[model samples]
Each structure stands twice: as structure tokens, then as C-alpha cells.
Target: MENDAETEKEKKNKNNKVIVGSIICTLLVIYLGMATYFRTHFYFGTEINCVNVSAKTIKEAAKQMTSQMESYKLSLKEKSGKTEQITSTEINLKLSSNDEFKRLKDKQGSFNWIFGALDSKNSKLKANIIYSNKLLQEKINNLSCLDSKNIIEPKNPSFKYSSTGYVVLNEVNGNKIDKDVLYKNIVNALSTGTTTLNLDSTNCYLKPKYTVKSKKTSEIKNILNKYVSSKIIYTFGDKKEVIDGSKINKWLNVDDNYEVVFDNSILTKYMRKLFSNYETIGKTRNFVTTSGNTISIGGGDYGWDINSSEDIQKLIDDIKNGRTVTREPIYLQTAASHSSDDIGNTYVEIDMVNQHLWFYKKGSLVTQGDVVTGNMSLNTSTPAGVYRLKYKERNATLKGEGYASPVNFWMPFNGGIGIHDASWRSSFGGNIYLTSGSHGCVNAPYYLAQTLYNNIDAGTPVVCYY
Candidate 1:
């Protein structure tokens, strides 16, 4: 009987322990379920835009954010260090649940909410916003700091050439009404559910059209300085004309996009001035002979002609490269050098009226004699004006019109007409060619033709005139 009672007491003690443990586990499960339920709503401490939304559902949190919108304010700071405020009623702001709230709500879980509540951290949601742009602009424009008289016009930045180089003029950010950007600020603040829109921190203001800090400004300045700092000089004998930066600077221009534009009219006017001052082609000249005789001569392809098209490009290049040189101008038809008379005293002068010839060398008469000209009565007369010596030959046959004559020296200056030795003619000049002329040649003495041929070379000027 004693053994049965001990066994029964042990069984009773074991059953009581099992019952106490079962009660403890049941109470703990109830506590955990309640904590998870509360956490599923919102953590112990949660804030959305500084509004307490702890343990609240998505609809409840949205309701809390909406209530704060009515009393919201926007603080705008001006360039003059003045602060401006706008009431929520002015802009008609409305609070709305943004993606931030949805994301926070999606992250709430039974297991994760436990650790979040243990951390005792404050979680805040952004205030997504909406507002009327027109109302925002009206309220901003009505501010005391933004009055009509107080408003200043914004000026775009510019670049001007100085003595040193191209300099940038700072953009003038005048006190102007920036209703456009201020209206955007209202929308931004409403979207993010921000109670206070700070203009100073957000950089929301009226801005100038251009700024010196722009990359295009530097690009334009580089091009302007390249043209403005260049130098070019054109030389005319001892006189020279300089195209300096002051003149070139006038040709430079910057468009709205900061692109460089050179005014070709300025270059045209300058080139016109040069043409009027120094051009000498087609101008009448007073010709003086080697024998000290003066005659007026003009109207021929016998003077310097400026190559306007080619030289203009070269001049522009030299100016861009800053070249300073003293040399003769480029010419199309060059005549020795640009001076009083292109044909100097060192040339062969044939006086058809006097029927005389003079060979001048270095302003001194080297040879002088008479020469038979073409038969004028027969209409076979030698053409007048300036020409160049074509070539010279020795022991050449002169063939023309049933006549095959041979000469010791042949110096042709004009077409088939030339200076040659004629053994058939006994006397020269005095209209020897009037009836019995030797074609259109100047029949000099046998010795004179050889002497003249040996002295002058090709390209020597031969002035034939009456």
C-alpha cells in the first residue's frame, strides 16, 4: 500500500508541472500575437513629416499628413537677404500619400516589426504634395520685397575686348520676379509633402539669360581674343599700314548662343580704303626716258595689279597669325615695283617718229643709232607700246613672202618683227622702208645687231612708240 501511494504522488507532481508549463506557453503566445498585431499597424514610434503616425494604418497616416497641409508655410529668401513667407491657404496645398509612404508600409512585417520596435527609433515619411501654380505665383508676386518698382531687369552676360585681352562681363542678376521657378517650387514642396519650402537652400530665383561661368562663354572669349589680339601690316615701299586689334575688335561679334561671328563688312571697308589709297594699275603715268625725255603714257597692261581674291585671303591669314612684315604687295600683273614709273631708264627705246634707237643700261646710254622701221605706207607698220623681248638667235634664217634672208643675229621683240643685221641694205633709216623695206624688221648694221643681241637678254623691256 505504501509503494502505491509514492507512485501516485510522483505522477501527481509530474502532471502539475506539465500543466504550469502549458499555461506559461499559452500566455506567452497571446503576448506575442498582440505585439505582432500592433506592429503590423505601425511600429511603436513612427512619424510622417513630424506627425505622429505610430500604430496607425495607411489611411490614418494619410489623414494625419492632410491635416498639416492647411497650416503649411513656404519661407522664401530674396537676394537682398530678406525673408518672405506664404501661407498654405494662398497656394492651396493638398497633402497626398507618395511612394515613400507605400514603401514604408510594404516593409512592415510581423518578424521585422519586433526588431524595429526594440530599436525604439523614430521613422519619418516624406510629405508628398500638390498645389495650384497660379495661386503660388500670385502670392509670390504680391510680396513686399518683390514689388514692381523693386523689381530689376535681368541682363545677360557679355564679352568685350579690352586693352589687355578679351574680358568677360559678369551677368547682372537683377531683382526680378521669377514666378516660373517659384511656381515649380510650390509643386515640388507639395509633391514631397514639405511644410516649409526654403527658397535660399533650394536656389529658386529669377536667373539671367547668360552667365560668365558658362562653358560657351569661355569658347566665345577664346575665339574673340584670337582675332582681336592679332596684328597685320601692309608695306608700300617706305610706307606701311597696320591693321591692329582696335580695328579687328570691331569685326568680332557674339551671338545668343555664344558663337563667334566676324563682320566681313568691316574687312570690306578696310580693303576699300587700301584699294583707294595704294592701287596703281590702270593709272596714267608720266614716262621719262633714259635720254632725259618726258612723255605721258597710259592705257596698257603695263602696271601692278593687285590680286584682290588671293591677297585678301592671305591678308586675313596674316592678320590672324599676328604677322608684322614689310614687303611689296602681291600683284596680279607685276611691273618691276610700284613707283612713279614701272619702266625705268634701263630699257631699249625705239622712237618711230624720229627713226632712231637708244639702248640704255643703268640710266646711261650704252648704244644709239638709226634703224629701219616697217613700211607705214604699205600698212605693214610695227605696233607701238611696251613689249618684252621674246628671244635671241644666231645664224637664223628669216623667211617670209618670197624672201628667204639669213642674218648673223636675230632678236625678236614683237611677233615676226625683230632687230636683225641686213647686208642687202646699204643705208638705214630716213624711210628706207617707205618702198624698199625688209619686211617689218628693224634692219640695223651687221655689227650693231650682233652687239645688241649679245648685250640684252630675254624679258628686257622694249618700249616701241611714235
Candidate 2:
């Protein structure tokens, strides 16, 4: 009976030992499984709750974190609701083992503790992104538009960029820029967020090439008035009376009653002084009455008489010594003929074929005289053409006439042929036959020769017909 009882006790002890061993084995398996899951799933330094999060989800959280960095680079930020979306997925996985739980406890206390910590870090990062993006947007909004006020008008107004200096578009006239159009374009471009614009440099610019205040019309008008009043008019020939109002008006191209405005600048001060103190002998009058009697002095229809004869003489002297008005150089025709208006109507004409020269005044013959020709042997034939009596001298000597005497006058006819007072030869008619007859000169009587020499100028036409 004692042996059977001991064997029953040993069997009971073996069954109890087997049951304890199975319980310990099951706990060890659970611990190993949880440790493996934490090791494979959690990021290092993450909270315990993050341990059981999938690796794929962790990678997605890293990607979302990188977005903040990207936003900073682009000068932008995520919208307000976007922060919540990022944090919900990144903060909510459960802890699965004591190792993961210990990591969270040491670093962040617990799963609930880790969740709040991560949410706080992410919230701060999102706020920074938002602030940075707002600042960038404000800067872009405040950027100034390139309008007319800011656009630089280069010196001399050129369409091209010059490294050394500005080039002129139109040096003679002026420069014209459309400021209104330029301003409008700049404003439009800025409103639409455009980067650059095209400008035209080819427009012609005026003399004063620069940008000025737009409302300076009065200053511009003053400058123009000064320029216009500086002009002066001059006339040639004898001072004749401007008889008719219409004639004076047509000549001046102004109204008949308009006042003549003269420049009183330093350039004309001396001229004004001279005219104020002197008396003019020949009047340049602008007629105002119908009888052609009323006259005026200077440029107006008002008269000022001379104080004395001495004043008249002084005026004449001033005119003679004053600087002559010069005109712009003009090229004249090269033809040898003279106009009828140039030479006076009262003049003389010499006819070599008839062997006589005649002086005429207003178609009436005043004087006539006999003439001679040159000898054929010496090749001193009288030339046949139109010529003018150039110059003369008294008490002249005749070298080809074979004798030296006090001749009264010397008249060179054509190519050294001259008529002079032949005092040495006392014979007349039949060529006079005096020493080879003559050398192309026409010997005339003394009195007629003296009168002809004193009356002609260089431009007088001497027609010689064979």
C-alpha cells in the first residue's frame, strides 16, 4: 500500500512540471515575436507607439517631412489644413514590445507622450513654412513697375545703347518720345506680371535732347520769342520810298499795321545807339498817306527830322564806315552778256569799221570822232569784238607810236589798241602815214580823246566790227 502511494505522487509532480514548462515557452515565443516586429517596423529614436507602424508608412512619413524642406526651397508653404493630414499618420502606431516601450519611455515616456511630441515638432515646422511663403509673396507684390517716371532718357536720345556716350537721333530738329504710351505699357506689364518690354529707339529727337517737366510751355514760348525777334532785314541799292501799304506789307510778309519788334540784345545795342543820335540823308520811308507825301523813319510810319546839316553829314559818314551787310554766298551765271538794268542807258558806243566812235545819251548822239587801225606787217590787226573801256591815265607815253610826248589821255580799245592825244604827229587823214601807220591803236583828236577817257568804266561794252 505505501509503494503505490509514492508512485502516484511522482506522477502528479511530473504533470505539474510539464504544465509550468509549457507556460514559460508560450511567454518566450510572445516576447520574441514582439521584439522582431519592433526591430523590423520602428525607426530608430522613434517613440514606442511608432514601433508597430509599417516600414512603408514610415517611408511615407519621411517623404512628407521632406516636403517642408522643398517648400522652403521654393519659397512656398502648404495650406492651413495640410498640417493635420501630415501629423495624423505619423503619430499613431502602437508599441508592441518592452524594448520598443523602453525606447519610448526613455526618449519620450510612452506612446501617448511620443504622439504629442511629434505633433508639436511638426506644427512648428509648418508655421515656419507659412511665414516664409507669406514674406516672399509680399515682396513680389511690392515690386515696382517700369513706368515713364522711372525710365531713363539717355543723353542725346538714341535707340541704341552706347558704351562711351549717348548718340543723337535727330541732331538738327528735335526728339519726340511718347511718354504716355511708355507709361501705359509699363503699368500693364507689371499688372500682368510680365518680365521685360521692347522700346523704340528710332524716333527722331529735337535739338534739346533730354527729358524735362511736361508742364513747361511758358518757358518754351519765351525761348521761341527771343529767337524770332533776333532776325534783321537788309536791302541793296538806293533807299527808295515804300509808297504803297500793299507793297510794304507784301515785302515784309506781315500785316500792314503790325509793329516791327526789334531785338535790344547786346548784339544790336551798338546799331541802336548809332541810329538814335544821327540823321539820315536818304530816307527809307514807309508811306502812310495817299498823296505819297507822308513818310516815316526807321521801321515804323513815324518821322524824325535831322537837327542840323552836321548831323546829316555824320549819318553819311557812319553809313560809309559801317560794316556792310553780307548775304549768303551765291553762284552767278558765267555768261559774258550784261543785263540792261546793270549798265545805265546813257553811255557811249565805238564803231571801228566806220573809223569813228560816238557818244549817245538817251538815243541822241552827243559826240563823234575819227579813229585808226594797226599795221598788218607787225600782226597788230585790230580785233573785232565787244569790249569795255577798263581804265585810263593822263600824261601817258606811247612806246609803239615812235615818240614820247605828254599825251592828254590814253584809251586802250582792244588788246593794247588805244586812242590817245598824238601830239608828235601833226598830220591828219590818209592813215596819217606816221611811222608804220600805227600799231592797232586809234589816234584821236585831243579834246574828243579827253572827254571819252573820263566817261567810261571797265564794264562798258565796246563793240568792234570789221
Candidate 3:
């Protein structure tokens, strides 16, 4: 009985050993079979170039890639909200077979197939893509964005004058494409097996030379604002002429290079008009004489004469510096006052009709006397006009075409004409000038000539009229 029991136990142990050996043999065979299969086929969950090639043989992966390329189409998104397409057929695009798939499968290795299957195997494969360059360029050229009729050229930023001041204007972006960049992007898309190409994202469009955010654009805007900020007040006596942004903006502009430009000629025109309106020289004026008779006087080298060139340059500099100035323009000539009656009450008055002379200093009567003027018989009557005192001299000789007279006090106002004492003449004034007169001079008494020569200065207005 004991021998039989021991034989049973031995038989049970042998049966268990044989069952475990068969299970090990089966697992080994399956592992070896899968390892050999992975040598030619991609590991599970394998991906190449964004396409899944899991559990596929090299031939199978190549066929799948070729199939995808046949129907490949790239969508180009434009700035104009328009969509354009480039198909594989249009560019004659095809997948050129290479050993890259075999290399990828070898890199995974049969033994590491479990790791690849358990985890996602994602990779990028360099595709040998073949396409006709000429055909691709032709297709790109035929795009609607490249069409002349459909293309809207881009415009650079600019400066516009407004009520406030000069302001910077934004640029206009249009549907113009950069052909060279577009061509390169399309080839890149084909090489990577990409389906869509965004033209805007790829910077495939032509850009404006200057945008509102550009450094040069901002700089020019700052310059323009500074120029318009100038406030210049031109003073003429009690009157004020204001020049501010409204006027300055008219002269401001921007060039093609986004730089500030000013039209100097426009400012020149304004200056000329201002000068014409305000200048008193050579203009008719009203004068009240000592005899209480009002008279009209004209034709004189006196009163305001603007120095336009110097003042214009000064105005430009002031505006550039953004200066606020209240001043008067430079003048080559000026008068006692900037009024209709520019000649104040300080002058010498000679009345040819009355044949008398009077001198006023600061509205006060300085001297008065009877005087003999030009000889009417000789037609050398002292010309009637306005003039200034050239100079004063003592013990001077007055010479003419036929006569030379010596004088004690000589005050010359016009050429060859002056107020001087005539030692040869015993009497003066009245109609003595009708037949005999001391040339075209005011033949005054020694006392009157002495008073005038002592009180008068150069540039003192000498008014001679009938």
C-alpha cells in the first residue's frame, strides 16, 4: 500500500512539470514570431510625418504615403478673407520612394516593439517629395491674389492735417503676395507633407514700407506735431497777428520716405502778402499841416520795409524749435509809428504856394520864417514831394550849373536843394521866387537857417509841397 501511494505522488509531480514546460514553450514561440515580424513591419502605434503607420510593413507605409500625396491639397489663406488652393495634380507632385521607412523601422528594433506599442511612437520622417518647379511656379502665378485686377497695392503710413494738428495715418494692407516667399513656402509644405499653408502666417504677402507702429513713422509724426505746436504772434504797433497750428499745418507734409517736409514757398507767399498789407513805404498818406490844412502826401523812401528773407528763416527756426514767440518782424526801414500817419509831428514843412517854412519838433513849433523857393521863371521851382534830411553843414559852398553861393548854415533835404542863408539876397519870401530866387533852395534868414541846422538830425522827414 505504501509503495503504491509513493508512485501516485511521483506521477502527480511529473504531470505538473510537463504542463509548466508546455506553457513556457508556447510563450517563447509567440515572442520569437512577433520579433521576426517587427523586423519588416513598423512597431504598433508608429507615426511618421503626422501620418499613422502602426503595424504596417515598409511597403505598406510607402503605399499609404503615396496614396495620401495623390490627393494632397494645400489651402492658402489670404488677408482679403479669400481662400486659394494648390492641388498635387496642378504641381505634378508625387512621393519619391526612399529607404527612410526602413531606417525608421530599424531604429525601433524588434526587441523594443513592446515599448513602442505601449507608448505612442510619434516621429517626423524626411519625405523625398518630387514636384515640377515650373509647374508649381505657374500654379502660384495663376493664384487670384497674384492677379493684377484682384491685387490691391499696399499703402505706407502718412501725415494728415486736422483741426487739432498734424496726425499720423495708418497704413493700408492689401492682397498683394510676395511671390518669391510664397514659392519657397509651398515647396517647404510639400517636403513636409503639410496640407495647409497660411499665407499670412508665413509672411508671404508684400508689406507696407512704413506702418504707424514703425520707428521712422513715429519719429516723423513727432516732428510734425512739434512743428505745428508753434505759436507766433507778430506785433505791428497795437495790432496783433496770430500765427498758430491752423496756418502752420498748411505748410506741413510728408514725403515718400516718411519724413517731414515743409513748403517754404507757401510761407514766403504769406510773408509777401503780409508785407504788402502792412508796409507804409511808397503809399499814400494823410498829413495835417501847421496851417490847419489837411494834405495828401505820397512817394517817399520812408516807413516800414520788411526784411522778408531774414524773418522767414527766423520763423522756420522758431517753428522747428517749437517756440512760442511774441515779436515783430525785422525791418530794413521804419518810421516813427506804424500808423496811417507814419510821420509823427517832428518834421520840416515847406509850403511852396505860401513860400514859407516851418519846423516842428515833437509836435512843438520849433521855428518859422519867410523863405524864397525855386524860380518859376527858370522852371526850377523846388519839386513838391516828401524827402529826408541828407545832412547839415556850416560855412558850405552851394554850387550849380552857372552859380556858386557861399552859405553860413546849410541843411540839404533833396539833391541840390536845401535850406540855407542867402547873403546876396537882402529880402526874402513873397513872389521873389517868381523871377529871381536862390536856385531850388529855401533862402531863409540867418536866424531861421541857424535854428534848423542846430535842431535837425539826419533822416528827419522834410515835407515839401504846395
Which candidate's TM-score is highest?
Answer: 3
Q: How close is every model to the real structure, measured as TM-score?
A: 0.49, 0.31, 0.60
Candidate 3 error regions (>4 Å): 1-28, 44-49, 53-67, 95-112, 115-123, 130-142, 146-184, 202-230, 248-272, 280-303, 316-324, 341-466
Q: Of models 2 and 3, which has the larger lDDT?
A: 3
Ranking by lDDT: 3, 1, 2
Judge candidate 3 against the unseen true structure and give its global Cα lDDT, from 0 to 1: 0.84
lDDT of 3 by residue, 1-466 (tens): 9999999999999999999999899978888888898887888777766678888898999899888888888888888778889898888888676588887777788867667756544234666888898998888878888889998888888788787766777898876888989988988888877788889999998889988888888788789889989999999999888888899988876777667777888988987798777787767788887788899988756677899899888988999999999999988877778877878889999888888999999989999998999999988888777777888999999888887788999888778888898877888888999999757888998898889889988878888888
Candidate 1 structure quality by residue, lDDT tens digits, 333-391: 55554567666666788887677788877778777788888888787777676666778
Model 2 scores a C-alpha lDDT of 0.39
lDDT of each: 0.72, 0.39, 0.84
Looking at model 1, report the run of 10 residues with the lowest lDDT sum.
113-122
Please name the candidate that would achieve the greatest lDDT relative to the true structure. Answer: 3
How many residue pairs clash (N, CA or C atoms closer than 3 angstroms) in each of the candidate models, in the order given?
6, 10, 0
Q: Model 2: runs farther than 4 Å from truth?
A: 1-208, 211-345, 361-364, 374-391, 399-406, 412-417, 423-440, 451-466
